[model samples]
Target: MADKQLMTYEVGEQMNLMALLKNVTVRVAKNGKQYLDLTFEDQSGEISGKFWDASAADIDRFQAGRVVRLAGKRETYQGSPQVRIAGLRLANADEPHQPGDFVVHAPMKASDMEEQINQVVFEITNQVWNRIVRFLLAKHRKAFFSYPAAKHNHHAFEGGLAFHTLSILRLAHSVVQQYSSIDAPLLYAGAILHDLGKVIELSGPVSTQYTVEGNLLGHISIVDGEIVSACNELKFDLNSENVVLLRHMILAHHGLMEYGSPVRPRLLEAEVLHQLDELDASIMMMTTAVEKTSPGEFGERLFAMDGRSFYRPNEPQAGGPAVK
Candidate 1:
């Protein structure tokens, strides 16, 4: 068997390796010299690198998504490891590298996640909601499974959208079981379609960025519009109360107007959807932060979490004495 490729390398390590060129940009230094700022990645993780005093010819030769051989010294910048590239060139055809080895992916298998999500759709007994959810899922199944939840926030990896949606669906199922009054169909639909618009909102799975529609309308409005289009195609009544409620859930899933929800969640189902969405996103953010930090130390401040840092304890602690 071939030796295992490293997911990450240590700082101060001088090495030559093959990795995907995830991103590249050119910028001028203070001395009027140009440099290439690049991000390289393998299944392990991503790292930034700077090719100082790069020539125009060099820039022309490098492009994103291509596998390349890189020789560099790893160094630290602001507590993160980065590379100072000494040399770089496209990998030879004979090089034992596979594109799949360089990309990050969700922990769960994509096919398994898709199957589980389909099972949830099958459970939605409400005909109208069930049809709408199935239509949207079928229409965007490719992008839905391929795109990240965000460019660089929670669930920002391949298959993230489905992973995030499935996570929320699981949470909503428990919430509905606990609160019998909650509408199961609406909540399930909301969980699956809350971020459906992100398929068009994000550029793609690799080195993603916001598209024109994403930047102008955002995912909330984009999916709201999608609901209208889907309703038209399906010949569903536009003015039906069920349609309005579902649309409202998507519009108000952001929960607060300040957070970009055009309208606040007014219905009970909408409110629950918003809360569950927040719960899933917050948990992912916190877990990601904690995992990145060393045990017994505080993590870097998370700007999205109100700039609060999290602590990762070295030892697991049991719950305090149970109340009598």
Candidate 2:
């Protein structure tokens, strides 16, 4: 008998259906088609599945971000392995762990990402900006260190918000410094502080979910309001235009009303931050999704990322077919 490759099942492995699924989100498909679509992960990474006739009774048992067992044969679509459900149900606490179990992260490593943020902070020479940055970084360390950038968008892994935000700001600063026409401190500060409110907007990894505060007051307002309060405390010697400009960058980072920004990027620095932030985040999402996908196959459809499908690159040639 061919040993099943754990996550990659062979023809007739006695796999437990409920043990292999992760982030199992069940919902009604179009035209009343009972369906379930969710990612199944192993140590190798995550892959998604869609079941056409997932039952209503079983639907209640499986929820988003929950693991379940499956007893089914492995099937492929477009060269991707998908589980055709012979049986499925909720995985109990005491159920023996399976080899190909999927574990979802709480965004993506916020603490290490925060250290990257501090690199940008140390570069600022403006004392007032430094104080404001310190206060928020200190006060909201928990949220700042843990929250996902969005509920389902890019950087949705553990500590993903912090990692993405820091990366965007750092990259943006590098580019802006070349011109020297832009104020380095202001632009970098704006970039670093741009997504500070995300801590409150989303929950941490332990919970791996959103909170009431997030639903009501979003990251934009939370961050904008915090910046205003921090400025008041620091007694910043800023003209109204400077304050407004910085605030606009935070408010407009989302870049569109439909997307979430109340105001668009108005100033040069604000425009730069918005564009760079978007560019970094989008690239990260696409690249990470691609990495999780199998080689010689197109990746799963990313709904939050405009339903864009990505193709995994073919593996490099194995040095001319193994010289004997």
Top candidate by lDDT: 1
Question: In the order shown, what is each candidate's alpha-carbon RMSD?
Answer: 4.2, 4.7
Model 2 stretches with alpha carbons more than 4 Å out: 1-26, 29-37, 40-44, 50-60, 73-81, 92-111, 206-208, 232-242, 292-297, 301-307, 320-324
lDDT of each: 0.84, 0.69
Report the lDDT tens digits of candidate 2 across residue range 258-294.
8789988777777788788879877877887676566
Candidate 1 lDDT over 1-324, as tens digits, reads: 442333345557785888888788899999999988888877766777888888888888787777889888877564445788888988898984565567779889889999999999988888888899999999999999878898776888888899999999999888888999998998898889999999999988776778999999999999989889999999999899989989999999998899989999999999999998888889988887676555666866778899888887775547654222
How good is model 2 by TM-score?
0.77
The best candidate by TM-score is: 1
Off by over 4 Å in 1: 1-7, 96-100, 315-324
